[model samples]
Target: MQETIKKIFTENIQVQIAAGEVLPSALESAAFTIAQSLINGNKLLCCGTPSCHMLAQHMAGLLINFYETERPCLPAVALAQEQVNLGAIANNDEHETFARQIRAFAQQGDLLLAIAVNGNEKQIISAVEAALTRDMKVIVLVGDDGGELVGLLGPNDVEIRVPSKRPSRIVESHLVNLHCLSELIDLTLFPQEEN
Candidate 1:
């Protein structure tokens, strides 16, 4: 048992470091793009699964709290349907509701950050296409297998690909990488002020 526990911890740390190596560049690019978009006067809309949406929400919180950017806080507008509780109305919407909210939230200089694990969902792809057509800047953070999502992105879009093959560690690694990104964005966005 002692040996097993020691091996587990060792393996876990190694896996995290390896995953980090694959993630930092993408995360940096995504965070920089987001910070730039907000600095240039763009509201942001993030959409993804419940777990990934939680990540997006946390990212938004970090942006507001640490970056001090005057950006709008709009989260997974499309996934906000099916609310058993009125309090959950804010983040639970169906497809049409998401579309409607997205259309209203997006503008010429605004941005849409789409988060996906598989990147092959029809609804998500469609939403991404719609956002792109409207000329909003797009930033996609998807797992490496999310090739389908990549096809929809244009030159202005930034893509962050995280290698999440291990189901057991994907969520944990993703959260760590994302939190690092949030911290970096905070540092990068506020360097001048900090100086």
Candidate 2:
């Protein structure tokens, strides 16, 4: 059992390190994109699959509350955090749950930040499409080769793809990536004075 635990840790670290090598620029771009939208007085809309649902909300909380340092609340909404009535709009469809919300809440220059345990989440793909129709920029956090999602991104969007094929490792990398993005956004939007 101890060996299994250690193996998990080792693999997690290896995946993170590998992702670190290729994902920095994408993370930075996503941070800047988010900051720029906020600067333009646009809010962020987030959604994801069940596996990534908390992560979507976590990103929203980081922005609306604070990443680390206390700052003014930023405009961010997690679309599915407490949507008890999504069924009415979604009609049992996955992405429609988010797509309906995105169409109603999203505006030009706003941003949609979506997370996927893998690239083939039909819900996320549909949500991304909906956001595009609303003229919102997208930043997708996906694992593996971005599956069908690789073709969905537009010129101004960013895709932070974790290199690992393991779902657990991808999720862990995503959590860390969110933290980094939040930190960069804070630095960009509310720079601290260097002592």
Candidate 3:
């Protein structure tokens, strides 16, 4: 049992380190891109698979409320829960649920931040496709070779593929990635004014 726990911890750290080596520049680009979109008065739309959806909501909350410290709320919305709560998801096609919301809410220059813990997140890919048609920039955090989602991204989009095959490690790394992105966005948007 102890060995299993230690393996998990070690694997998580190793994945993060591998990600840290390759992802910094991509992270910076993504953060700056997100910040620029917000600066242009465009909102952020987030969605993910069921488990990853919670991370999407967390990112939206951090942006729309506060990340680490108090700051003016930023504009963001997590798409799936509202549909589920309103009972729309059941009525609408499950695959198009997020894509439908994106068409309804997104505008040109808006951003979509999507997290997919594995390569099999079909709905997330659908949402990415929808967002693209509306001219929204996209950032996807995916793992396990990025699946079909990788094939879909255009030159303008960003895909932060986690450096891990384990779903747990992928999800954990994604959380850390979200926090880093949120902090970077805050820093970019609200640099402390010199007294």
lDDT tens per residue, model 2, 29-81 = 99999999999999999887889989999999999999889999999999874
Q: What are the clash counts of all predictions, listed in order?
A: 7, 0, 0
Q: Give the distance in Å from residue 42's predicted Cα in candidate 2 to where it truly belongs.
A: 0.3
**Candidate 3: segments with Cα more than 4 A from true spot:** 82-92, 193-195
Superposed Cα RMSD, model 3:
2.0
The digit string of per-residue lDDT tens for model 1 on 10-66 reads: 766776877777766777787787677767767677666555767666666655554
lDDT per model, in order?
0.65, 0.90, 0.88
Clashing pairs in model 1?
Answer: 79-93, 80-91, 80-92, 80-93, 81-92, 81-93, 81-94
| Segments in model 1 whose C-alpha atoms lie over 4 Å from true places | 1-15, 67-93, 192-195
- lDDT per residue for candidate 3 within 37-59, as digits (tens), equals 89999999998888788999999
Q: What is candidate 2's CA lDDT for residue 152?
A: 90
Please give the lDDT score at residue 193 for candidate 2. 100
Q: After superposition, how far is residue 114 of candidate 2 from its true place, in Å?
A: 0.5
Among all windows of 10 consecutive residues in model 2, the one with the lowest summed lDDT is 81-90
| Candidates arranged by lDDT, highest first | 2, 3, 1
- Model 2, runs deviating above 4 Å: 81-83, 87-89
Error of 3 at 162 (Å): 0.5
